[model samples]
Target: MAIYRKLEKEDKEKLVGIFQQPSAMYDYREFDEDALIADENCNCIVIENDGEIAGFASFITYRVPTKGLVGRIEDVIVDEKYRGQGLGRGVMEKIIEIAKEKKVSLIDLTSNPKRAAARKLYESLGFEIHDTGVFRLKIK
Candidate 1:
């Protein structure tokens, strides 16, 4: 079983373990905890299994003139050992609860097309494919 809670600096190593999985889509060698928490809108959460990190999820809510309030979910990942156990859904449920409290008009996230399981999970959670052009320029 996994218990979900707000992320903390002490979770750094355990979180690294979870992120080591391929589905995470990023080679995150380290986490900038101070920088993240410095942002008042950051909501990072972790799932723990027997004192070890089993999953991660995060979201940020903000308002704009055109869109009102919206929440963007970020970097949701579960350790390979914890997959198919509903841990991902559990983490997303927590995000939704918080997003509701924040009164967000929408909650959004992006998943790699190769991640079929993840896409199915998101769909089961009531998330639909929103047609939009997601572009990025690697400035570095």
Candidate 2:
């Protein structure tokens, strides 16, 4: 059975392994477990299969004047060895449950066009592509 729950300090190493997979597109950052666990606005989930970490995901919730509380999911990934076992869906479902509990008015996520499977999963969970442009500026 898979266990889905909030990220724990001991999970950092295994979570890092998942992000290091070639399929993970984002620029890797050193995880500050203390900050992550202490942040009131961040909700993170880790999936454990037979006592080993199988996947990880997280979302940040904040209040917007117009939208009220909104959530943006980030860094969702399943270990390469565990793909196709519904662990991704399991983690995402857990995030959605947290969002609902927080009364999030909207939730958003971004995926590279190459991530067809991830896109399909999001759609299956009722996420729609909004007609908006995403822009980023990297500042050191």
The prediction achieving the highest TM-score against the true structure is 2
lDDT of 2 by residue, 1-140 (tens): 89898888888877777788888845557588889999989988888988888888888988879877888888888889999999999888888788888888778788878888988898888787866622111111
Clash number by candidate, in order = 0, 0
Once superposed on the true structure, which residue ranges of model 1 sit more than 4 Å away at CA?
A: 133-140
Q: Per-residue lDDT tens digits of candidate 1, residues 26-67?
A: 667457887776776889888887777888988887886877
Q: How many backbone clashes does candidate 1 have?
A: 0
- Please provide TM-scores, in order, for all candidate models, with all chains considered together: 0.86, 0.90
Minimal lDDT window, size 10, model 1: 131-140
Q: Which stretches of candidate 2 lie over 4 Å from their true place?
A: 133-140
Cα lDDT, all candidates: 0.77, 0.81
Provide C-alpha RMSD values for all models, in order: 5.8, 5.6
